[model samples]
Target: MSEPILSARAVRKTYQSGDRRIEVLSGVDLAVERSETVSIRGESGSGKSTLLNLLAGLDKPDAGEVIWGGGLGLDVRSTFLGMVFQSFYLIPELNALQNVLVARRIVGGIGSAERARAKDLLARVGLAERSHHLPSQLSGGERQRVAVARALMNQPQLVLADEPTGNLDERTGDSVIELLLGLCADTGTALVLVTHNAAHAAKTSRQLFLHNGVLQSAPKPIQP
Candidate 1:
């Protein structure tokens, strides 16, 4: 078998609340293989987002280690991974196309090729006509679509999405989830999604529930 794209080795995290130190994650382990889609579901405040932050290297674990298979070092970290969040973190001044191109900032200077790639990604996210529109001009769903395009702009091997659909309506959320899964599958990108929606979670190749700061297998839902 091939090595995983990401692995969390007995991760542990804690936070101080007044005089008490609350343990958020206690020795959690996870591994995501290439081109695989994995969804994590848990109760609110179950440390789902915290686990993602740890996985993305945005936050350090109190114990254990996160190993990225690519081993690209800190300099190329942006190239090795992509990320999506509950809030659409687009630049208000930039258009949808420009927002996507921002992901290439670490790569090199933007050129015609980069611009073209950004356009293509915007189109893939169903926002081709709105490519020139600013985030302020877009609807909630449209904004999130732009965020999705931006996440894939780097052609990252893995994407860590935390509540990507949280702000959208049910129908819109469902569509976003579908698009995210399709794009990852088409690009052969590994995905670790943290969501609260059961139906959305079931769409992934694997599902796990985070309980008591540990991950447990979930019964595979029937595929449509």
Candidate 2:
């Protein structure tokens, strides 16, 4: 098999809320290979986002480690990772083009060519015409599309998306899903998506259920 772009072994996490310890993950393990699409599905409060945070190095596990490109998260550097969230977390001040460019600017700042690349990314997401619009000016789906383009701005090896379509209508959400999967496949970027929508999860190459703080294979085909 191809080497895994991201992997977690024996990951454990817990939280203490006023002396009440809540265990979220217990020895959870995951592996995502290059250009592969993996979906994580679970009921609410199952800690799916927590696992993603650990994988992205946004949070650390009390035990175990997350390895990316054969190195720890910090060792891998932020440029290797891209993130999209349920909410379109676009900067209100920046326009669509600038929003995408901001991602590149964060890593090493942008040059003329980088600006051109950002435009291309927006075009790919079908937002080239809306490139000058602000978040308030765009519709829900358009904003999400902008977020998707920004996630790809860094050309990251792994893209971690948390409910990318959660806020959109069914038709718009389907379009976003197709665009996200197609872009990942084209760019060879590994994708790990966390969503409650089984029909959406079914489209991925592999589906895993997060239950009781552990990861397991989905029981059967997910009916739409």
Candidate 3:
């Protein structure tokens, strides 16, 4: 098989809380191939978010390395990495289209073509009708959808999402998950989704469980 789009080798993370040291991750290793979806499931405070941050290079791991194929190790920033958090980090003042356009401009450079691509992404996320709506005017699910579109605007090789469905209702969450999976498949983008919902994780190609700062593959394959 081709080299993994993203790889983490013996990754470890720790934080200093007051006078105490807290270990968030312990020698975790992971690999994501192109166009594959990998779900990381864990209870709260099990380091799921920390792992995502490390993978995306938002935070440096205390130990181990994150290697991005076709690029050097994680450094200033990774152009091939995109991330979405539980909180919809959309610019409240910007409309849905503008939010996605900004991301496109950041990675792909500003151009009429990039703006058009941004519009296409919003449409793909089923937010064409709400493109002009601000985050405040959109529902929670709508806002998350806008975030998803923004994350995809760069056509990243790897997408990291943390609790993507944490804020939506069951039905809305399911729809959002479906949209995420479908878009990633269509675009051939690898995804690493961090979620607590077993049902949500079950949608991915592979599922991993995080416990006590360690990660292990799920016993059973995740059925669609």
Candidate 4:
């Protein structure tokens, strides 16, 4: 088998609430292969987001490590990782086109070709006509589509999405989900999705339940 694009080894995390210590993740491990999709579902406060953060290098594991592309020293923000959150993190001041360009800028290779790619991504997400509009001018689903475009701007090998559909209504959420899955498939980007939606989780290649600060295989979801 090909090497996994990302892996976590015996990861653990903890937090302090007032005077009490809370263990959020305990010896968690996971691997994501190229173009593979994995979904994690858990109750609120089950450390789902924390795990994603650790995997993305947004946070450090208290006891273990996360490795990307077979190493531990990679910069998550560079070309290796992309993140989408429940709240659209688009800049209010930047238009959709410019917002997508931000990722390319982050990796420090801005030019006409990259600009063209950004515009193409906007069109892929059905935002070509809205590319000049600000986040406030777009609908919630439109904004999230822009977020998806931004996430792909750097051609990341892995995309870590945290409740990407949490804020939208069911119909809109389904569309966003379809768009997300379709893009990831087309780009061969490994996806690590953290969501509470069982139906969404079921669509992935693997479904995991996070409980007691650990991850376990979830039952196979019934197919229609």
Leading candidate by lDDT: 4
Off by over 4 Å in 4: 221-224
Across residues 84-161, which tens digit of lDDT does each residue of candidate 1 receive? 999989999888888899889667789998889999988899999999999999999999989988889989999999
Q: Candidate 3, clashing residue pairs?
A: none
Candidate 1 error regions (>4 Å): 219-224
What local distance difference test score does each model get?
Answer: 0.91, 0.91, 0.86, 0.92
Please report how far candidate 4 places residue 65 from its true position, in Å: 0.8
RMSD of 2: 1.4
Clashes of each: 0, 0, 0, 0
Q: Write candidate 4's Cα lDDT for 1-224 as tens digits.
A: 99888989999999999999999999999989999999999999999999999998889999988889988465555688888999999999999999999888877968999999999999999999999999999999999999999999999989999999999999999999899999999999989999999989988999999999999998676788
Tell me how far the alpha carbon of residue 222 in candidate 3 is from the true structure, in angstroms, after superposition: 12
Q: For residue 201, give model 2's deviation from the true position in Å.
A: 0.5
Q: Better model by TM-score, 1 or 4? A: 4
